[model samples]
Target: MDLHYEVLGQGKPIVMIHGGGADSRDWPYLAPLLAKHYKVITFDSRGCGQSPSQTEAANYIMDVLNLLNHLSIEKTVIIGHSIGGQIATEFALSYPQYLQELVLVAPALAGFVHSLDLLESFQAIQSAAPDVSKMTELVVNSPFCSVIKDSTHSKLMRVMTEHNIRKMFEWAAFGAVWPKPPAIERLHEISTRTLFIRGTRDHEDSVKIETHFRAVPNIQFVAVAGGDHMLNLTHPEELYMNIVTFLGEPNKQA
Candidate 1:
């Protein structure tokens, strides 16, 4: 209930979870478009944007469930990007009855081991520590994110990354809590229809993640040409279209 959330046009509910180092601000171009068709809910996950930093171990999956309960949303479609996608995946596996559909964009897997290159890049940023400027630069220039470098939204991406990085300093040392065994081990357990989307210009790891998602019973894959990990910001229209088709919803001009 303490999370900062926004609600858009009314219809079947659609929860939008932004990626790590990002908040709902990434959806300015996509939410309204999706809102035209269904009620869109966007929120700042704990320790990001306006959401409060956690003193206790963070359970992102529970945070999501609490948000849905607080809003009285019993069942809804979930659209998550990057780390957000990981959370959505676990939630769908743990509480399949609460989901109608799922959409993942350049998602990080729950149990899959990420590349050493990625782990080192993340560590480098953290090593920069309280040097907010250096952390922001490292993140913006990181391979998984370099796709945003030339876009007009690069400044926006930088600002959001900086905001989330600064908030990290306020969080406790406690690590985030995820479901047991992890979603990667249970991809076959997913019951809702799923749409997996990754950009052509994204990192090599994203390409690898796609191969793992083949276990899902009802799922579709999309490769966005020229899109990157930040597709929510750079390719909202494309994301929206793919989501519409996957959900079997009418394609509005949005």
Candidate 2:
């Protein structure tokens, strides 16, 4: 299925993929900042936003390939967040020749899964027949406690709950199948220049991702101080600057 995506600014391409339960709009704050230096593209993965869903389970690798093929993009940089980051890592592993650079934000990787609350939550969703509504609430509320900062936490929680509940449920169900991608053994195999970003205050998995990719010769890790998993939304300008620096591009023109 052809996914719906928005393109902004003009320059080398940088595709932004959102996490599960999130649409292209998840990058609204981040995309515009990057658009200043590179052509920024954000898309809703299949089964969410304006895209039509295929019967196949929502596989991150499939979505990445399809999006690249759909855009006829032979080469580009990719900035993936959360589950989207998992997809990006797989894509880089499978198609290293096509990537110019990779930026993983709060990426989920092998052994990054938490045992307590996070796994239990996902397990509950996976074992059951899928309750889109409950999952929606769960996802929206999951990050609130981690935000640390009161105002940002409250605002994001409200936005996620009120504006994208139904879409969130659909995304939750789509993501219910399969475990997060494994990148531990494959990190060294990835030749593409990579940058991994994590919020210092994010869940344990976020820090684990940083440590996982640290051994890779081509990867760099940047921790967003006082930031949460929602760094793209919470610190768009700074995130964009770091991405541009990794790509060896000039900062966006003010």
Model 2 poorest ten-residue lDDT run: 172-181
lDDT top scorer: 1
What are the per-residue Cα lDDT tens digits for candidate 1 across 1-254? 99999999988889999999889897989999989889999999988899999888889999999999999998999998999999999999988888989999999998888789988999999899899999999998888876787888889999999998888888885589998898888999898999999999998899888999999999999999898889788898998898888887544422
lDDT per residue for candidate 2 within 21-104, as digits (tens), equals 567867868888778777888988777667765455666676677778887888999988887887788788888878988899
- Best candidate, TM-score: 1
lDDT of each: 0.90, 0.72
Candidate 1 — worst ten consecutive residues by lDDT sum?
245-254
Steric collisions counted per model: 0, 0
Q: Which regions of candidate 2 deviate over 4 angstroms?
A: 123-135, 143-145, 152-181, 251-254
TM-score of each: 0.96, 0.83
Clash pairs (backbone) in predicted model 2: none
